[model samples]
Target: MTRRCIVLLSGGLDSMLAIRIMQEQGIEVEALNFKTIFTCCQDQSAQVARDLGVRLTVVGQEDDYLDLVEKPQFGRGKGANPCVDCRIYMFEKAKRFMEQIGADFIVSGEVAGQRPMSQKRRDLDRIAHHSDLDDLLLRPLSAKLMRPTLPEREGWVDREQLYDIEGRSRKRLIALAKKYGLKDIPTPSTGCSLTEPKFSKKVFDLMDAPGESRRWDYELLKVGRHFRFNSQTKVILGRDEAENDQLRYAHQLSDANSTASLFPENFLGPRAMLIGPRTDEAIEFAASLILRYSRDYDAGNALIRVDDEIINASETEQAKALQTIAAS
Candidate 1:
């Protein structure tokens, strides 16, 4: 009987190499790509799966996955990424998929010590144990340095063919990719917003805020320039025409938490969304932001739309000063 294994495909060089390695050993491989709100490489994963000639399965993070992001057990990295807990969540789902498809084991491209947060030696062991995939989870790229998994032990895969690659260097991996005749070798990237410092600041800010941040709040992070008005209110100003349309669409969603959408009615300015009480003060504050970012700043009193009502811009000086303070 031909052995089968499920590979966690991240659409990167390492994971692709792992798939190719499994194929070289005559083991049937199935690719699984896990997606979260922070992830931005689903298309790449799909394309890689096609290239590798493997069946691909895509899974998404559930709402409960947010619990780890709020507070990870093993803590975070340089950014808001709770990588250890996040990987555990991903593998737990992969374990279920493995059982569903009757695959013998799970494989990933994780190289020990490559990632400071989740790829540490101890972290790998912990993730395997926590996800209840102990001994069944294999890191093909670093298998020679780690303990043999069930597939290797049972002679389904040759341990000699496995690699000992570790650390942050990609020299050996790149060479291997060329050896495998791969046409598209992707550059290394986490491709996750949580790993970006600027985006992480916004995530931390949302976490520090009083109320619980929902999925919509996280989604909003991908668009607009965010400004904190108060503990109860934050404003998002679209930086471009595309973002302006996104803000308009977001504001109209049935589950939108925004109190109102503000835009310049008679002037060229960015659109904004208010995610709190629609007090007169809040509307006026939003109006000022519109004016501050508008191209036609000389328009003495710009007409601003607050939801369905049109109001003249107010407190221009105060809003300009606030923007300066925030920038500083």
Candidate 2:
């Protein structure tokens, strides 16, 4: 029987290459893509799997995923990315899939030292051990540099045929892609928004704040122009209509206490939402951010609407709010 393998395909160059490498070795490959609320690459992953002609299974993040996001066992990276914990969650799921299908082992495109957070050699081992894969997890790209896994030792996979590539350099991977006759190679990117510097700042701000609920706060991070008004309060202004709608939706997620979702009552300003302990001060701070993003209509006063109430905001209030919002 041809050895079956589960490949974690992130739709990136390295993952595509990993699947191809397995195919070249005559291993039957089933691609698995993990999806999180914050992950942006699922569509790309699906497309890439289709292009590769592999049967792809997409799995969603479990509710317990929020627990990992809140208090990651391995902590966070530059942003709110709990990469190590996240990978462990993914591999754990993959292991279940592997056993369900009677696949011999798991394969991944992970290259040692390629990513600062989760791709370190030690982190890789930790992830495998914690995910319960131990030596059952194989990274073909860096396999030769590390110890042979169960797949290799059992003759399910050929150890000598695997490569020893390491580090962040893609020169070797690119050459291998060429050798595999791959026509389109994707440029490398972490694809997680948590890696973005600005996004990281928001994540840290949330982490430092009190009473930060996991899923609610994480959802807010995905939308709006975030501004920190103070340690206790921050504002998110919608950049467009979709974001405007998102603000309204986010505001409804909690009761009147958790978040005081605010809107512009009088003016043609953008929608603004706040996630924090709602105080009178926090509400006003949120109001100010709304006015800041509002366009100056010919009318001096703008009508702003909060949940059930409306307030007429004057130019003076708008200006003060703009200053406050900018200072944040």
Candidate 3:
């Protein structure tokens, strides 16, 4: 009987190498890609799976994923990323996926000590033991340094064929990729927005707001000029045409309740969308941010609109009012 394994494919060098190693050892491999609203590399993962000729399974977090984001059991990383908790969630799901598909074990591209949050040796152990896949989970890229898993003990896989790569170095992984005849390699990145500091501020902002934040709000953080008006209010101004459309799209998200979306009604300025209470003060604030990005001071006054209704304000007045409003 051919042993089966599920590899967590993240469309990165390490993950591709992990799948390749499993295939070389004659283990049937399946690719699993887990997505969150904050994750931006799903397309890469899908394309990599297609290139590797493995059947791909895409899974998304439940609404409860928000619950974990709000408060993680292992706390958060540098940003809002609950790395340890998030890994536990993914691995726990992977465990169920293995049972459902009758796979003998699970594999990942994780290199010990490469990542600060969840790839530390201790963190890896906690993730495995807590997810209840202790001996059933394997990290082929670093398998030689760790204890052998059930698959190795049962002779379903050759322990000698696995690697023992460690730390944050990519030299070995790059070399292995070349050996495997892989090309067009992707640059190494955490592939998660949660790992970024600026992005995390917006995430933290959304989480701190009451009855206003949702997945939609979080997703829009990836595309805009984010400005925190207060703990309860924010205005995202689009920097260009692409962002302008995104701002429009964000306004239509399920949980968003902005009273009016502000746009450049008559000038060549940026389009700004408001999220939070749309009081007269908030609308004025949004207008002020819109003016800050405007080059239409020569137009004497710019006519801006909210919900298709126009408000004409002099460039100087708008700027002065916004500064006063922001300070108050």
User: Which candidate number maximizes lDDT?
Assistant: 1
Q: Model 2: per-residue lDDT, tens digit, 72-104?
A: 989888778899999999999999999998988
User: Mind giving the per-residue lDDT tens digits that candidate 3 earns over 1-328?
Assistant: 8999999988999999999999999999999999998887889998999888899998998877887888899988888889999989999999999999999899999999998889999999999999999999999999999999999999999999899899998999999999887896899987888888878877777777777455676677787787767767777888799999878876776666655788877778888887777777778778878888787444466778888688875665565545643210
Q: By lDDT, is 1 or 2 better?
A: 1
All candidates in order of lDDT, best leading: 1, 3, 2
Stretches > 4 Å off in candidate 3: 297-301, 315-317, 321-328
TM-score of each: 0.96, 0.91, 0.90
Off by over 4 Å in 2: 253-258, 277-279, 298-300, 325-328
Candidates ranked, most accurate by TM-score first: 1, 2, 3
Is candidate 2 or 3 superior in lDDT?
Answer: 3
Worst 10 residues of 3 by lDDT: 319-328
Give per-residue lDDT, candidate 3, residue 85: 91
